[model samples]
Target: MLIFLQERRLPLSLCGWQMRNRLIYLPISSITEWFAIPMVNLRVISLAAPFVLCTSLFALSLVQAQSLPTKKKSDISAPAPQAKTVSLSNIPHAVATAFCETYPNAALVSATWVERNAETCIKLHTSEGTKTRDLLYRLSGELIEMAETISPIALPEAVKETIHEEFSRAEILSAKRLVSAAPTLYEVTLSFGAEKETLIYDAKGVLVRKVEHLPRAVQKAFEAQYPRAEILAFSKQDEDGFVRWVIESREGQSHREIVYAETGEVVAISERLFPIDLPEAIKETLAESFSGSTLITAKRLTQVQYHISVSDSSGNTMLALDATGKLLDMDAQSEHVLLSLATSPAPSQDLKAEEDAIAPIPVALPDPEVDLAVALKPIKVEEPLAAIAAEKKERPVIIVRRYYAPSLGWIPPIMRLWRPSWWW
Candidate 1:
C-alpha cells in the first residue's frame, strides 16, 4: 500500500488538510489507484471519496451564489397609484360628510377616488354660486387642500383694502384662493390700465410675491415686430392644456391684437381698421358694391381676412372678405336688401322741375276804367244775337292749371273775364 501511494504521489499528511495553504490537485487516477490497495482499504476510500466530492460541489455552488449581483431595496419600485372616477354616492360617508361640513353651500360637480401612498383619497369638484372649487380629502375625513375660483368682490376685506391702498388705479380681473397653505393664500390678477400682472397674498392680506410678467422671449419677439407699438393690454390664457399670451397694442393710429404661444410664436393677429386704413382694392369694392352705405366697423383678422359691417337704406350687412377685396361671404339682416337695386321699382321723375318749366302764366288784370269805358261804348252788334251766340259756341275755352307748393302754402284761384267775339 505504501509503494502504491508513493507511485500515485498521494500526500501522507492528509491529517494536515486544514493547515494546507496551497491548492491540492487530486487526479482521477489517484482515486482509481486506491482500488489497487487491500479490499478493506478500498471500501473505506470509496465511501469517503464520494462524500468529499459531494461536499466540494456544494461549497462551490454556495460561493457562486454569494458572488452574484443583487438589487438594493431602494432600486426596487412600487406600482404607480391610479385615480378612478366615481359617483357622489360611491364616495365614503366620512369624506362626504367632511366635504359638506367644510363647504356647506357647494354643489358637487364630480367626485373621484385616488390611491396615494397606501391611503385612499377623494377628490371633488364643486360649484358655489358663481364660484367653482376643487377639493381633496383623505378617507379618514382629513382635508388635504381646497382651491376655489372667486370674483374680485369676494376677496377678503383685508385683501381688498391692501390692493386699493397699493394699486389704487388697478382693476381686478380674477381672484383665486388656495386653502391648503398654512396661512392660506390668495392669487389676484389685476390690470393697471393696459398692463396686467398677477399677485399673491397671504391670509393677512400681506403681499407675498408678483407671479406674472411679460416673458423676455415674448417681449423680444413683440419689440422686434412692433418697435413703436404701445402695449394696450397683456394677458395669459390656457386653452386645451396649452398656454397662450394675448397682447393688445397700438402703433401710431393702428390698433392690433396678437396671440402668441409660450415659445413666443405668433399664432394669430386681429387688427382694428378704419375705413381709411383699408387697402385701395377693399375701399373700391365697398364703394362699388355697397354704394351710399355707411361703414360701421371694419376689422382685419390675421392679416388674411377682413370683417366689415355696413348699414344702408335696406338694412345692415356683414361682409367677410379676403385681403384682395374678394368677398367670401355677405350676410344681410334683411333678405330684401340682398336683391339687386336694378330689380326694384324705377325712381320717380322730378315733378318739381317739370312744374317750374310749365308754370301757369298770370293773366294781366284790365284797368277798371277801361272796363267801364268798354261797357259804356259797346252797344253795337255785328249781327243778330243768334249769329253771335253761334260764333261764341264754336270758340274753345281755356282751362286753369293748379298745383300745391308746400313751401308757399295755399294760393287763391286766379279769376279772368271772358271777352266775346262779337265785342271784338
Candidate 2:
C-alpha cells in the first residue's frame, strides 16, 4: 500500500482515517492479532485500503473542481477592430500622394483608418464646389472604392443621351457617380411632372437597375380610369407610413396628375385647363366679376372645383370656384361682386358674335368700255329728250356686285347713280 501510495504521489490526508487508527504502518501479523482476524482477511484489507482511499480522493477532487467558477469562451475572445480618425499629415506618403494626384482639385474634409476585409484601409471625405465625395484606399495607395455627389450637367454625354432617349421629358433632379466599382456606376434622380424616379446606370451608359413601378392594383385602377390618357411618368411614395402612387398623364393638349392609395382608390386629381376650355358658366362669371382680368393659369380639381390665377390692374389674385361658378368662400368684397354678377344679365351668343364680327368695306367696280372721248363728252339740255335717252340707253351702266367672303360675312356694293361730265 505504501509503495502504491508513493508511486501515485497521493497526499497523506487521503488515508487520514487509517493513520488516526494507527493501521496504515502496522504489520499484517500485528493487524491480525489486534483485530483478532484471520491472516488471509488481514492481508486482503491491507492491499485494498490504498485503492479505496485513492478512489474517494479522486471523486472528491472532481466534485470540488465542478463547483468552482470558470471563464466562458466568448468572454476570452478578442474585440473587433474599430475605425480611428487620423490627420492628413499622419497618413502614409503613398496614400497621400495617390489621393492628391487623383483629386488635385478636391479639398479634404476628414480621414479615417478602417478595417475592410481584414485589411487596413484609409477613408477620405472631400469636396469640390457644392459637391461632396467619399473615397476608400488601401495602404498600398490602391483605390478600393469611391462615391461622389455631382451635378446633372457633369454627367457623361452617353449617360445624358441614354436618359434623354428613355425619358425625353424628364428633368434631372440629382446625380451621383461611383468610381472603382466593378464596372463603375452612376445614380440619377429625375422628375416628370409630379412624379419622381431613380435610375442606376453603368459607366458605359447601360441601365443597370431601375426601381420605379406602380403596384398591380394601382396600375389596373389608373388604366381603367384613364384608358385614353398617355402616361408620361409614374412613381410610388410613402407619406407618414401610408403608401400612395402618383401618375402624370396627358390627354391631347391637356395635362393631368392623379394620386392613388395602395388599394387602388383615387386620393386626388388635378387637371390643367386653358382659358378657352373654361365652362360657359365660369366664363360668364369671370366676365361679370373680373372683367379685363387676364388668366395666368387655371386648373380643375377632381372636376369639382376650379382654381384659377388671374392678373388685373390690381395685380394677381387666385380664385376658387365650384362647378356652378360660385365662389367657394366669399368675403364681403366677394359677396358684393357676386351680387353684381347675379343682378346683371349675361350677353347672348348671337350678340357676342355680332360684337366680335368685323365691318365690311365696299370696293368700286372698274369699267373698261368707256373711251376718253365719250367720258369727256358733256350732256346738253337743249338736245331732244328722245336723243339723250337713246344715248343714255346705249351707254353701259356701272353695277358693282358684292359677294360674301368666308372670313367676312357680307360686303355691300356701291352704286354709281350719277356721273360727272368727265365720267361716263
RMSD of each: 46.6, 48.2
Candidate 1 local lDDT, 229-298, one digit each (tens): 9775578767546676778776654667787766777766877676787999999999899999977446
Q: Per-residue CA lDDT of candidate 2, range 283-390, in tens?
A: 999999999886645678663446787879998788876433445553554675797789899999999999879554689898678788988999666658888988
Clashes of 2: 0
Top lDDT prediction, candidate number: 2
Misplaced by over 4 Å in model 2 are 1-86, 90-93, 112-118, 192-196, 210-424
Best by TM-score: 1
Error of 2 at 13 (Å): 99
TM-score of each: 0.27, 0.27
Stretches off by above 4 angstroms in model 1 are 1-86, 90-93, 112-121, 149-158, 193-196, 212-424
